[model samples]
Target: MVSFGMKDLLTLPITIVTGVYTALKFIYHCFLRPLQSGNSQKTRLDQASLFYEGQAGIYDATRGGLLRGRHTMLALSASHLRILRETAANKRLVWVDIGGGTGHNIEFMDDHFPVSSFDAIYIVDICEPLLQVARDRIAKRGWKNVTVLCQDATVFWLPEWLDGIDPRGSVSFVTMSYSITMIPRFHAVLDRVEHVLAHETGLFGVADFYTAEKQESLIDRSIGGLDKGCGWFRRWFWRIFFEFDHIFLGSARRSYLEHRFGTIKSLNGRNHFLVPYLVQIPYYIWLGRSRFRDNYPLDRSLELEYVSQESPGIPVEDVPLTPFHYSITKHWRVPYFLEPTHEKFHSFTRVFTPEDSMELIRHLEVSRDDSVLFVTSAGDSALHLAINSRPKQIHCVDPNPIQGHLLELKLAAIQSLEYEDFFALFGEGKHPTFRSLLDSRIAPYLSAAAYQFWKRDKNNFSSSFYLDGSAGQALAFMRSIFGVAGLSKDVIAFCNSDTLVEQQPIWQRKIRPVMCPTIAFLLRFGWRVFGIPPNQWKMLLKDGDVSAYVRDTLDPLISKYLLKTESHFFHLALTGHYTPQCCPEYLTRAGFERLRTNKGEATDAIRLHTKSMLSALRSLPASSLTHIVLMDHFDSSETRGS
Candidate 1:
């Protein structure tokens, strides 16, 4: 203070400026720079440590703003832990938190589930600085149970690190809180976690960012719609954007977890009000239990055998978790497809028999004693078999309740309505008095559920009921295209052509040229509208080219069966009506007599089912049916892997 030179006086201002500049740079890199993209100068682990080391003092404060769903995840974890604790009160409860940086997630959960709930809490991280910060936070909280250890989460099970904990899957709960995406070998880490988790008591909780690719099937799309996925473009954009920060947002992480465990609670949420790029960061919170359970045994052979013997006649509610039930419920809380609002939208209004029922009967050597399992789609093929082959029993099955309802309605109509009314409704594809008939004649024979379903949609019968359901959409689309291309007249001419030879030429020359290319394009890009899911479309083209499959295979087949024969199906496609000479067996005079005269026998012989084909088969005693008709069940291109 007493002695000052000219150089000393100059250094004071420079020192102050330098300190302020360094502070500004530190703040920018810790906060603002993370939000922006940049090339990484170090390894991923080193880079993560560097960012955390610099921001550790402000980590908890800064994270609360940008990171979302922490509270929700903690609540979910606490709920699961509470459930597990009831059963394992006497056992030593160990919770392992992999990559638990700063001990924040654990400390936050303490208020919810009490730190004393667990016998031991292992907070594992590779970064010593982050672990040091976690130790300080835990120490301040005075949680004697929590132990902070600096170790690689992916390889923490080394002999030196296993301090007397049971080696054979003794961990009760494991959590990875927004940390997996940063680890380079995350799969390896997950694999290790799965092994360490208690076989019967383990619960895993995770909350992290993820991006889902576009689903290729209608079922998949419906699922995605329920899941709240940001559409394909946004998902891809976010995935790439987050990858720059060594934060992976791929589907693999979530899918792997799902494969390893049974989901208990899962939710996908987006946080807004941040900057534009960070606004829609997709984070998911998931709670899952290990697939292994003490209450239920893994072996399903006994259950399968039981179902194989006694499923057919058992009440649907009484049937246990068969393969079919598992398929229907695995992805959704409820059967969304079977809900009344969605049911009618996807129903098949008219029967379009692509395969010749008479030919199938001949090939299979139809006999009076044979029992048949028929797929109930518009009830055309089953009715054909009933009339022509007259098999002893026909088990009509369809997973779609709407399709079964349609078949039931047809059966009720056959039992009650006279020949002319049946012909007008089905053969001609129109019935102005359908609602009157349904209430007066058809409703009496229908099941209570079916009756209710029809009563709600009685308006559908007033107009062209044949053109209302999803099956008619393809025909409607075709008609629109024909109108656009000026081929309506040509289509009529082809349908009107008398001889089989003349019909093929008319189809080849006029119809094929116009419709084939358009159909191919639609099949490739817009098959979903036609009720052809991507998986089903892939199955269609599994053997060869789509266009060639249509041209060489489908065209010839159609020419032989539909164009040449009295195939009312093609007539409906062309004119939306069926003539007397070209109609299903149910519309024929002799067939109608058999159904009308013997209503009880007809009803008894044809057992209509509104459940999955496999499930229906399982319900019935094994060897109950001599013949099985899968129909278009195998149309899906995507298999189990897809």
Candidate 2:
């Protein structure tokens, strides 16, 4: 029987067909569509391995939300077992928060659940910078039970870390708080947790935006928001500009990275080799989220939209002014600021105080053509720019609404709540505080977390202390909060980020000793440069030993705060226009302003004109107006953060 053998199966016709299909596909990809894929680059199967190493740098700054809430979640989930100092013995509770950046959760646990006894905390993450920060933070806290490591939850699971340095069956609770979503293949992490969990009795929780396809489409659409109205020119320019990141992380060191850290596990949706990473840019952009544009406008707009829709009884026009409207949670993060900044160059030398704003505004005058934007000008800084503009179309955006609203309320309560009233509101100290009025005023609006942290002491220090969470500046608040219980500034500073500890929370400790030098160097450099004055190096990692990698990454602050504008980037963030893409002040550079008549896309409008020489000259028009302030379209798009 002449059976079709291997050679016979390779018929000329079949071979030709295969060749034609392959050739056509190649042609289409090469000629028809644009292809900037990095398919040739090494595939990343063990993503955590690469990412865990990078955490030492990205920690704290990039981690979504502060580490405050995560601890509460863990403590709440604790199975009635006393953590750390249990009343009964042998009922040891364990926790593993995968992808937990910086191990702040551990301190949270240590702070609140001190009554209970814990065996260990396993913090897992893929970025070394973050892990290092986590380690440094744990060390400062003086936590003894916590442990951290930097291994991919997929492909390789460290049994010793999971079980114990002494015993193997001492596991308890496992959590994933917004960390797993950043991972490509989080299943491995989940599976390892399941496998090592203290059986079915072990507690498992995930405080993540667990979107099941429906949420995915919502996420995708939200991400695609960056594409809408981006215009071809801006889109193309950004596509290339963002690609530099791909070259640095993937293209340049593809092989060496793979050999050194194994490989990233999840490369899903990789339409382009660089697509996986590049896609974030468009998503970032389209959400109308510019680092320059404060998110209050978009966030508040959406919330208002939801409120307006859900409560048909309410009119859209009434939403802004209606007392009932503010009572509702609708429109949480709207574009409250008129214009914002979006320059990568701005983050370094950001406008820090109200004085900075005035410095820049001195050179100009505002007229009909000029739409002036104040980074934040309703309260303290507002006092600076208020006189500058005649009609006053100033807009305000701050993150801590409790704090901001308190400021707004202060005026209404002015004479009614005078002198000591101000101190009583925020003046718990032996001396009078500048924020005395606000402290008394914002008492009702404290967040559950803020309240929880503040509850330990009955001497309510006032709103200014709790309002210390100035965007990119949290040290003051930490100091204030710590001071309430008699913690000294030096001890607080040391405890805030002591890098001397040997072990870390599960979120940090990614290094294997070999990477220590590089880690220390970078830490030192980042603390010295990017760490800023108020934030201090210790705030990031509490480390005395700085690494070379961290040191080299430090760059000078690029954004300048004008003493003239009565607006500063810090104030803008306080007002709520904080994002990485742009700063509100950047729009001022383009000659735009904030006025009652002013509406929509300040930075973008100016950017379009700036691209053209004659048009930009025509747009501003030789002092047709007196002063020009720049702040528009700086905040980037935010994913549907459900």
Candidate 3:
């Protein structure tokens, strides 16, 4: 047994008292303290200085849990700077951090980007205490290139401007982390920001508290149709709660920011670390470029010529540009169709292709010079073509915008994810940290509409990305039927079989008798779940009855190919997931490695078009495409006279 002495008996009580005192001190400084008790006429600077005078020592320690998305904002800004620097390598890069408290963002940014790479950096703030702490940090870190300016953001200027050097349109980057809400004249500061940023290459990044409602009509077309709305209760509650601290959480700030800049990427997240209550606070991170039309660096004349399909002598100012022409991603996806109201297919129709991709590859004989056009059904065939042929370009056309979104998600996953994460997301059909990965890794490459769609439906991966869509529902129903009939073991065994001699008996003895009748019944009554329309069903009926059709389809597939090693389509049907040896080529290690090489040049070769196949074909130049794979679309078109 352990013995306790007088010193040990007193230690627990002393430590408990010290802990309680610290907790109360933190709570009092953060929440209970008043800014100005009796003077209501104090200026913004006076109020800010008095409020932060006592809390400056503990600000970093106490606010680390409350301030979320700061590092993410810094990371995104660093990425944009790297890309922008490549274009303007000869120019000097300048950065400005507005309302930079204690130089935390600049210090943290060194982890993502070298602070010495910039020619100059400025930290503008109004509070003296915070500026003193920032000066101390700069001295300790020995950042000779950094300067702290104890001035208001709206009237701040660089040292070169004082020497008559005219520093306007010279800054390369500007950032505000949780500081926009504290400024009384945010519009003036934003105007100042726009004036100082470089003409075409400047980048603006901001992360702050916000509240908004879901209003589709208010979405800005130039921002790629991004909607970051919260619930009604959250909108009202956070707005009222933040008023006590003189921090505004209304939507006006975001709206003004969007109006001032052309958005590149925007993400919304919740900070759930408020101790004692654990209430979620909403925050957002936004990145953008200059909004002036004249500042756009892309070739407007060439874009107009391409859109008109004429000679390259058209005057850009004479033609009115559509929203699609101003795409920041420079991809072919149309934003108007990506809206939820215009969606024809809310859920995916096919999880995997029924046509043999290897057979199609052999017959098409694709080459490096060939450009193939095909329907984007779950993106499996396109991946196969990209890996095998290494084509110059592949145009993926689909009427439903969700199908294009699905393909975009897969491409982004291929470009960013490691092989294990890629296998877990696609092969096993589920992942635990999909939302985190989606925000951090996969978001930079996707369009705003695609990012928003996945952000809203990220829970699909939490259960099973392959078990939530319409086709997956059908598979789920079939799985339930197999479970009821005690055929689950045989289904597993059929997928695990080594040879045709072993697979045929299990199929004939256990699965075939139950599967054929069910498929026949579903074909007659409920075939839409299988993505077969009335016209396609009529085309199928022209050959034979439903029972004979089902028998013919299953017998030929099972007789010709082994289920375990040869056919991944049927294996997925019997079992809801795929194994390493029996899966799509893109999901295999060798295929993934091939696509991952050369910084994802193969994935970049594919362009997505969200429109009808006819419209997509009409837009392309004649004789430009070498191969066109219609799959079963020809049958549907002939039946409908399209």
Each prediction's Cα lDDT score?
0.66, 0.36, 0.78
What candidate 1 gets wrong by more than 4 Å, as runs, is: 1-346, 349-351, 533-536, 554-565, 635-642
Candidate 2: segments with Cα more than 4 A from true spot: 1-58, 61-72, 79-91, 155-170, 213-642
Which predicted model would earn the best TM-score?
3
> After aligning candidate 1 to the native by TM-score, how far in Å is the CA of 224 from where it should be?
31
Candidate 3 displacement at residue 230 in angstroms: 6.2
Candidate numbers sorted by lDDT from highest down: 3, 1, 2
Task: Give TM-scores for every candidate, taking all chains together and pairing residue i with residue i.
Answer: 0.45, 0.27, 0.80
**Tens-digit per-residue lDDT, 1-642, candidate 2:** 867787876797797886676555544533354334433323342333343343344444333332223433444344223221233355556666777767766665565456135665777655556677788887887777676776665543445555544333345666666554444455455455545655323444444221111212221222211112233554455445534323111111211111121110101111212245453321100000011111222224543655566566675443332111121111212222111122122221222342445555555454324544333322433433433444223334333333333333332223223334433332222224323322233222222122222333334343333233332233343334335634343332322232323222211322212234433543455433322343444344554434543433321111222211322343232222322222333223122223111321221111111111222334343544333342321221122121
Weakest ten-residue segment in model 3 by summed lDDT: 320-329
The digit string of per-residue lDDT tens for model 1 on 1-642 reads 689899989999998887676556656755466542344423545666766676676667657756776776676567556555656788778888888889998877886678887888989888777888898988888988888877878777634235775655778888888887777677888888878887666778788777876544333332223344568877888888777566787877766665566555555667663586557777776666655444442234434455557555755333333211121001111122333334444455334554567667667776879898877777777777777677888877766666766777777777767889988877776778776566445643554345445655547656455566655767677788999989898888787777767777778777888788877877787677566656567768787887886688557655666442366666776777677777666778787887667443654567766665666777788888898977566554234332
RMSD versus native structure for model 3: 5.8
Per-residue lDDT tens digits for candidate 3, residues 70-93, read 887887677667767867889888
| True lDDT of residue 331, candidate 1 | 15
> Which whole-number lDDT from 0 to 100 does residue 577 have in model 3?
78
